[model samples]
Target: MSEADARLQDMELPTALYESTDDGYLATALTIGPWDAGLQHAGPPAALLLREAERAGAIEGGQTVRMAYDIFAPVPVGPVRITASVVRPGRRIELVETVLTAGDERPLMRLSAWRMRARSDGAAPEPPAPHPAASGPEESRRELAAFFTTEVAYHRALDWRFPTGSFNSPGPASAWTTPRCTLVAGEPMTPLQHLLVMTDAASGISAVLDWTTATFANVDLLVSLHRPPRGDWLGMDAVTTLGGTGAAQCTAVLFDAEGPIGRSAQSLFVEPR
Candidate 1:
């Protein structure tokens, strides 16, 4: 799933992103992307899948170290069927896969993750320091993505803070984001859920192509973390490079208030709208 800052936490979003029901998970308006109000944004649905993955492969002191998502179809803003299974079961490491179906039918996406045992006794080098000019959440400019719809949607669920370029500026960009809403109706977001929900939008905040004239869709998302992300604020220092053959890729360094935590990448199918 894809899409914020820490004291922005003070401004918690008014509603949850999705609701649970006997049939399946019901996506709320918050799940809508700007591109299509009828279709769901990739981020919230990604979070739903990851949440199931975490539950299916629960282990003591375990954490998801690496996660990947493959989108087979655009998610719709309706009931979603989710199923999770453990692919490889182990004590130290495990692989869990989750599949999402639209209205209990079409398989819309797949999520796979490696859950690893956590340890306190470890020796490692410190995370690299932020750039001298790296802007904190409060220091950055407040700029939302160019929404195809003006009504509150997925982009409105989070606060955006850009220290570098913005959606309109193009090229590489860096931003700090904080979610305003809870991932599920009744649950407080876990560290993993918090990260996955907003991590997929790495491309949107750092788009190299103009949104009005071009269409760039991320085919897949890959995230590798050195540690479990913490706090309410997460930052992405992202770069996108376009290829001549109608392809593009975005790579972003992920961060929390403490420092760098991990990285996320997306491969894009790009063309003019």
Candidate 2:
């Protein structure tokens, strides 16, 4: 844990969470999650699935409009396999399915995304309401949950700034984040990759429960984009709500320096750790 004590800028971070292999990838310490050192966080793996989904190809000039992921089993911090294929292909829209698996051939996670070709007539989506009180990213504070041991990898590998409530604060919050390291070694981080890697953190960043005593783990993540995002810095204005049935949900307005781009939702199972 001492290794992560140094601030991100003061320490050289690992380049990527996974290294591409013939079958899939090998997980590195950089992917460690907050809850367990042996399990990888959801964000990086979500990004990896999107990367492969896009690579499998979609309609010509297609843009990803929605992506959904389901995590049924723990993702181990070791070698894993991934595969992507087009499930529904058409001239105007397409759907892709990607699966990540660990040893024994059981899936660690399953994901699906929808892509659509731009309207040739230049039609656009209905505009979204502007965030009520978003300050610039520069005005945000640098912080995260203090109780999390320094050994956690994914959160520390990136820079986070809160323009509203912080990771330590239990309430609705807004923050800007950008990864300090590349998503894959010797490869570039695409716009979609940049956004996916950070969207999953919304539940943690705006958690309304004490993380030390309670567990609020998201079982799924869904992100819908109205337009392509620009730049590396991504922002989210998020909130979490819990029900009496031990079910919870987190919602976030996703954006970049340019403006509003999309929204993210995560479903959680709440219980004592």
Candidate 3:
């Protein structure tokens, strides 16, 4: 990995084990960086909750799972409780919900993850035309450094290249990306996790009246995963729209070699810079 990538990889939660008390509750404390939003930190905490369910034998092999997180409040930089409960346990599918609460038991975020079994057969669709190659990382990184605040901690888990040139000048900028960090211990970093990371990077270029378009924080994020990520190289083609009222939105359709894997949308708060 490059130096920047190595730096990013080292920032993730290094451990999964959570300390439990006699009451069987797992709680831990964390510090959030200035640029770190709640959603970005939500994934690791949610994963920890899932692992807890696994250790308790609530979920097993040969099953499929789906997970979602609802951000209730900004994640605090301190101790919080992560709790998991099984909603439905089926022979082939399992439904699980996890919650992270701050001190005094106020909800910070809630996640509902699904687990299920795989089918033996499936149909095939024609593949899409290939995207043009992206630009080198060194160039893209320099452009990114100009707008994004250097203070926020960014996990360099992925290598990103932009084929279309700098987003700072305007128009379409496409990025090809791959993970530099090793994913969670047993889980192979599914498409869900890929979407979780790449979805937030879509709005990096536009300039809004309230906030700088570069490195905008997402107020809400939603991703629809259509297929498993087939290759290490994934592509993101993003566009931004600014409203007269001073807010903005960015949408990016993400793809892998097999085809269009999924798309992501973000609602952002902006003010004139």
* TM agreement with the true structure for every prediction: 0.91, 0.91, 0.64
* Cand. 3 Cα-lDDT: 0.53
- Model 2, runs deviating above 4 Å: 1-12, 123-133
What would the per-residue lDDT of candidate 1 be over residues 224-260, giving only the tens digit for each residue? Answer: 9988888888888888889879999999998888888
lDDT of each: 0.83, 0.84, 0.53
Candidate 1: worst 10 consecutive residues by lDDT? Answer: 1-10
- Best-fitting candidate, scored by TM-score: 2
Candidate 3: which stretches are off by over 4 Å?
1-68, 77-81, 88-95, 114-116, 122-125, 128-144, 165-172, 183-191, 205-216
| Model 1 CA deviation exceeding 4 Å by range | 1-14, 124-128, 131-133
What does the lDDT come to for candidate 1?
A: 0.83
Residue 39's lDDT in candidate 3: 25
Identify the candidate with maximal lDDT.
2
Angstrom error at residue 240, model 1: 1.1
- TM-score, cand. 3: 0.64
